[model samples]
Target chain A: MAPMSFAGKTIELDADGNLANRGDWSDDLARELAAQDGIAELTPQHWAVINFMRTVFEKDGDAPSIRRLTKESGVDTKMLYALFPKGPAKRAAKIAGLPKPKGCI
Target chain B: MTQTAEPIQKVSIIVSRGSLEGVYPGLIMANGARMEGIEASLFFTFFGLDAIIKKRMNSLKVATVGNPGMHMPTILGAIPGMSAFATSMMKKEIEKLDIPPIGEFITMIHDAGCEIYACKATVDMFHLKKDDFCEEVDGVISVGQFYEKAAGAQIIFT
Candidate 1:
């Protein structure tokens, strides 16, 4: 498959469809997302949760199971699901800004 | 020449749902935003808190009633098929269409530096301690604080 692109820029890829800019994080993404209702109000709990989600993606190239996320991050899965609505991996991936996870597709 | 402002301003979404159908839109939109480089956030409140809960996040079912256009697999879902099996099949189809798991998609947004918030009032109302939530959450905030962040940002409720 071809790479993902944004704003007239094609996503740079690695051998494994990995990203070229591993540390491409920018506050703009967060600010833009924060404008949305689901994400507008950030809390400490949410931050740790999303960050852990990113960590999982970075390490596994996939999202974490809720059980694993709770075990690893200590966030309440019940609560997380309530916040995400669409299953945590999918919801979190978008907010966290990694590519759509591989296995998810 | 008059300067043209950037179209497609950033917008954030708040999702508060416990059922499968309710959650899908939020997850889909958040990822969709990241795909388009728009900002997205998903704050869990009240019953919507389920997605953030680790153990229960996987097997969440969408309530059939009160949800229009939520097509269920009637033949398989009802006529002697395991609910788990049916649910997984449906989820797989969605995933095949590139729907990220709530957790994974949330991570992708964060990886791109999007915000995720938990509602403190909702947690308290539900009598949940902070220990009940995931570490990826930025922190807890009241609705007022949330609005402070949401100022000048597009707010969507899903």
Candidate 2:
């Protein structure tokens, strides 16, 4: 695990850079993490996905897969890719402060 | 001897088992590889061909024999309906998580740009036709063709 510095506060990140503790996550943290991943800012659509992912993770105890994301998040597959690029589920989970999504590969 | 490093950009997965648990690991790996921006190809042969056969793909079973996960004595595993019970149990669990059925997963993998190939030798031996396969199957190819296509890619047999 590595430490991420934001607002003079040190936060822990998993080896893959996801938040080490979901309870430590906040909206500002997500914004910082998203920017770290190269996104300039989080848009409303991005918030929709981030919130949806966090909600699902809180209930399911695991991040949702891309299949589940598209089917349940109200965000279609194409837009998901466009919004997150590269790997949507993985990026979204990281930004949402959840564990890496299952079945991402 | 020093080995030169060559970036791996693709993975070739060979699926030769027919059980539900056996078939899924390959799909999971292939899907994972693709998510990492790597190209993935799944070559199905022998009993693995059941994964692409429309009528059988959704009906794959978990083998109780030799499966420590079964948690039952090996002799009891030979009882009829045990496989069906196991399959149904697995299916229910998967469905609860909203995972797509095997057929849909195959299509999803293909749509994700992973090439799905049927082994020609097995196709001939089983007298299977293209129509017998699910739409996700790109084509049937000989072992030589698969070898050529798999050239330079990491090969995994499951």
The candidate scoring highest on DockQ is 2
lDDT of model number 2: 0.85
If candidate 1 were superposed on the true structure by all CA atoms, what would the RMSD be?
12.2
Q: Residue B104, candidate 2: how far off, in angstroms?
A: 2.2
Worst 10 residues of 2 chain A by lDDT: A77-86
What is the C-alpha lDDT profile of model 1 across B1-158, one tens digit per residue? Answer: 23475644466678788877777777666655544446566777777788777666666775544444546555433544455564676688777665566766566555544677888988888887777766667878889888887776778898
lDDT of 1 by residue, A6-105 (tens): 4455655444343445464444554444444266666777678778878888787876655466668877545665555544555566566665555422
Can you tell me the DockQ of model 1?
Answer: 0.06
* Local accuracy by lDDT, each model: 0.64, 0.85
True contacts kept of each: 0.05, 0.30
Cα deviation at B61, candidate 2, in Å, is 2.5
lDDT, candidate 2, at B50: 98
